[model samples]
Target: MRRKLAAGNWKMNGSLSAMAEVQALCEAHPEPKVDMLLCPPATLIWPMASMRGEHPLAVGAQDCHPEDKGAHTGDIAAPMLREAGATAVIVGHSERRADHGESSETVRAKAEAAHRAGLLAVVCVGETLEEREAGRALEVVGEQLAASLPPGSTGETVVVAYEPVWAIGTGKVAGTEEIGEMHGFLREALRKSHPEAADAIRLLYGGSVKGSNAAEIFAVPDVDGALVGGASLTAEQFSPIVTALEGA
Candidate 1:
């Protein structure tokens, strides 16, 4: 069976003082049954990973450069993230796609880079409100999955997160049915290209995920866990969500 994961993305938020929550979170779930990950901004990866101590909490980075080494001014290479203590990195987040105009091909290259540097790539895909309302949600996400996943992707190297563009950070969430449909679609899509590892690959739902609705969301078939946003900022908020998944 695939192990469930609770991955937090700190986005552009958090500073040195925010490390307090990391301590509280690790202390709260010293021996959590499910996998726990926190992808803070690049600035905190080293500090957060160091502070994790012997806790099961894994630290990750928000993004990385597609190349191992380059003259790219503001870009970080995957190897650097690995050296900085991050074992995983997120790519193709909707925010990046919108704000930076990243394409699926770029995401795939980044995923390949993550693999080359021995980091798990948490690839994200989602449909905008217009696409969803037009009933093209599945089609859009499916295309993204096909193009964004790296050539050698497997369960060990990749995790897929489906976050509806309309819902992210908007205090909205896809209904359980909607989440279930997209996750199921993503799994089948993964099988097409990764037949051998499809079942092992975990599919996570993201979008305003919190304690109040985590249990119900976890109940959905094919939903291995979540890629939490704002709610993951604190132990008091995230702990309950983690507890809900452990019970699921």
Candidate 2:
């Protein structure tokens, strides 16, 4: 069976003071039943990882450069993230895709770099509101999934996150039926190429996930967990979501 995961994307938020939340999270779930991960900003990765030493909580980075080193000003490389004590890194998040104009090919290369640095790649794929309205949500996500993941991806090296663009940070969330359908479709798509790793791969749903709706969302089929946004900033808000995933 695939292990359930509860991951938080702090996005561009948080500072050294925010590390207290990580402490609270670790204290609340000293021995959590589900895997827990937090992807903080580049500045907070090392501090958070250090504070989490020997704890069940794992730390990750929001993004990374494809190259291992050299000449990429203002860019952090995958290896650099690993060196900062990050065990995983998020790639192709909607903000990155929209704001930086990151294409699927670029995401794929970054994932490859994450793999080379021995870090798990949390590859994000989703559809915009227009695509959904046009009945092309599946088509858009399918294309992103196909092109954003690197070749030879396995369950251990990769995790897929589906975050509908319209829902992220807008206090909106895809309904259970919508989430389930897309997750199931992603499973089938992964099975086509990585048949051996498909079943083992955990699929996470993102976009405005919170403690209140977490249980219902987790109940959806093939939804192994979530990629939480704003709600993840504090233990009080995020712990309940983790509890929901544990019960799921």
Candidate 3:
């Protein structure tokens, strides 16, 4: 069975002071029934990982360079992140695609790099508001998922997060039906390539996930967990969501 995961993305936020939340979160669920992950900004990965102690909390990186090493001045490669105590890295987040003009192929390359570095790649796929309005949400995400995933993806090495572009950080979440449809479709799509491992792969829903609505969202079929945003910055705000997933 796929273990439920409560993953948080701090994005460009958090600092050394903010590490308190990580300690508090770990203390709150030292023996949580489900998995917990926190993807802090690259600067905090080492400190956050170090502070976790014997807790089950896993620290991750928000993004990583596709190449193992190069002349890239501002890019941190997957291996570098792994050395900094990160066990996973998020790829293809909408912000990277929009702000950095990253393509699906670039995302695929980064996922491959993550695997080469022995890190789990949390590959993200989502449709923008315009695409959803144009009735191409499924089509858009399907293509992105197919192209963004690495060729040898497996349940242990990859985690797929479905975060609608418009819903992220907007206090708006896709309806349960919408989430279910996309997650089910994603599972079917994963099966086409990794039929034996598709069912073992954990599918996470993202975009405006919080304590207030987490349980309801978790009730949706095929939603193995969530990739939380704003609410994850604090233990009080995030613990409830983790508890909800534990009971899911």
lDDT digits (tens) for residues 193-245 of candidate 1: 99999999999999999999999999999999999999999989999999999
Which residue runs of candidate 3 sit more than 4 Å off their true CA positions? none
Candidate 3's TM-score reads 0.99
RMSD for each model, in Å, please?
0.6, 0.7, 0.7
* Residue 62's lDDT in candidate 3: 89
How well does candidate 3 score on lDDT at residue 148? 95
lDDT of each: 0.94, 0.95, 0.95
Could you tell me every candidate's TM-score relative to the true structure?
0.99, 0.99, 0.99
Q: How much is 148 displaced in model 3, in angstroms?
A: 0.6
lDDT: worst 10-residue window of model 3: 21-30
C-alpha lDDT of candidate 2 relative to the true structure = 0.95
Q: How many backbone collisions does model 2 have?
A: 0
Q: Which ten residues in a row have the lowest lDDT in candidate 1?
A: 183-192
The sequence of per-residue lDDT tens digits that candidate 2 reaches over residues 9-68 is 998899999999999999999999999999999999889989887897989999999899
**Model 2, stretches more than 4 Å misplaced?**
none
List model 3 lDDT by residue over 90-114, tens digit each.
9999999999999999999999999
